[model samples]
Target: MEQKRDDTARDAVPAFDWDPRSEEVQADQIAAYDAMRGRCPVALGAQGNWAVFGHADNRAILEDPRSFSNAVSAHLTVPNGMDPPEHGPYRAIVDKYYTPWRMHAFEPTCRRIAHRLVAGLARDTEVDAMAALAEPFANEVQCAFMGWPETLHGPLREWTRKNQAATLRLDRKAMSAIALEFDGYIREQLETRREARTSGAEPPMDATTELLGEQIDGRPLTDEEIVSIVRNWTVGELGTIAASVGILVRFLARHPDVQGDLRARRHDAGLLARASDEILRIDAPLIANRRRTTREVEVGGRIIPAGERVVVLWASANRDEAVFDHADEFRLDRNPADNLLYGEGIHACPGAPLARLELSVLLQELLGATASIEPAGEEPRRAAYPSGGWSTVGVRLA
Candidate 1:
């Protein structure tokens, strides 16, 4: 369905194209969002999609699942891709896995992983934080959560990178090949778990078990559904967590005052958590989330027709001046209002608590062990998609 335009409205929203991979491209994307916010809070884009750039407008869209749906696919993000009523029960199956209590139980293991990763960097004066520490740290924690063999970490990381590349590829054959490879990987894991169950050994407490045990609408989920959910988790969690760590470290390095304050307040996990939120606001891992309009609706005074795809620019919304004062600067003192980094509404990320726990422990371990972190010789590389950050961030440990 195409979006309908109101001829009576005088102001015409400008069209903007974006390529998120290049720093120049990203800067331009931000500029475009800022420009749209200045003119109209919500505007129509060149792709015939509605774009909500202002903080308030973005929040409204996120909070109203009835107005917008989360079922975007080929990008099946469990629960992340399901709408309410239908989405609620499926989400509940794994919701408890990320609660504060559950996170607390996982803390010791998280801390251990962080300590080991940071300690490994101690031997090297400078290391690529993304590859040497962040990626491995996220991978190990994910492995711990899924109860999968640790050997899968390397392949998992590789698969995530390939999946991102596949999304950007113009060739259908390339994309299909990547999808086939990942499907095979998931099938292998499922077979391994089934064998364990047959042998009467204790089945692992990982995502596979949790997913296998889950019943949607009182019937067990099919293997295809399980694979879809796990694939989303694997693809979404690993790279983003690794990228976020790099962003946080890079921000601290550039802002010594903030770094010093964080280090001084090391004992306060709450403060550390707030600091993480502020960092996320400053440099979001994902630029936007794609959602398709289900029915004709009005947003920001513009009428959006059904079936048109919309890209909610989360990074722009996080920094919108309407909701955040001094929105451009990183201010830890700012009240961390619900930022849409983990998304919102019925599609709000179920893994948020776990991600938060991993990040907090990583920061705590790094601050406690190292005096300071500085950029090494390597230049930072951003991810191919609009939804990711640094591919490599080298840091010199002090």
Candidate 2:
């Protein structure tokens, strides 16, 4: 029962069922994605890539890595942009960096960063969650995690914005420039370490310095390789982390009961973490991930040819009515395994442990610091495509 479409559909490609960057979608992404999921789960985009919005389709795509490859990027992305046989080995290198022991070791520093940000928020006043809270917390934590200097905080924030703009424009030149700009920052740290080692002086023992000693296939990781790896980690840590903060803060503001419940049990780390996942599941922070088809596939009654592009819309899939009965309701009792907050299959997020820890700690601090969190005067502004969650959420803390 595949939906019939002529070769012209293939020729035009992204016959885009809907514009991801449209003013309508940008105005209310969740509603737009939800409507698409219900009406047309699988559709070709304007660029010819099939947009998969249903939960079942996304799960099947994620599970069948053989048919859906992760090598969607032209640039090197360490483990994230590689496919199996190659993916597993590089993934091993990335996994060693996020072990429970590492997260435990980093918790104190992570909490200090979270606390400093939360404590700085003025009480009973209107504050832009993205500017005064979310962005700074994400930036400082990432810098701390990478063992980068505090001087990098401002540049990295600006870099995230430029990277997002470049991505939205699909401007390879701007993308390349921003990427090199990022590389220069990373390379500066690497050079400092090299100089310290040459002078027989000890360098700072941090993640960046530790990465210098890592080897893949029995050879030390090259500067280019290390930069690529760090770049991937930085993007994951900074961009999504900021989005998650804004989303979480706004969610709490909108739902006072949920906020009050969590505030009462603020000491319960496990409950708070699960709540974070549920909140994110209802409103995704990272919208979509791209994949390339290895073979022809039939999904959601549509015929997709081989060598085509695919976009898995997490914001829609997680809220698919088929899976979550109410879809939008925040329920703490829902099964955690079913949630795709960290993705699925071999390419699942390796930094999830660290992310969970950061989120749990941040929520705990916010609840403890403020008596309540509620919406401020202006309506929360949704972020544009390529980014999910609120761009500017005004919240009043008391």
Top candidate (lDDT): 2
Each prediction's whole-model lDDT (CA): 0.76, 0.90
- In model 1, pairs of residues that clash are 146-206
Provide TM-scores for the models.
0.88, 0.95
lDDT of 2 by residue, 284-348 (tens): 99999989899999989998888999998888889988889998899988888889888999988
* C-alpha RMSD in Å of predicted model 2 compared with the true structure: 3.8
Pairs clashing within candidate 2? 13-48, 14-45, 14-46, 14-47, 14-48, 16-45, 16-46
Error of 1 at 283 (Å): 0.6
Error of 2 at 348 (Å): 0.3
Clash count per candidate: 1, 7
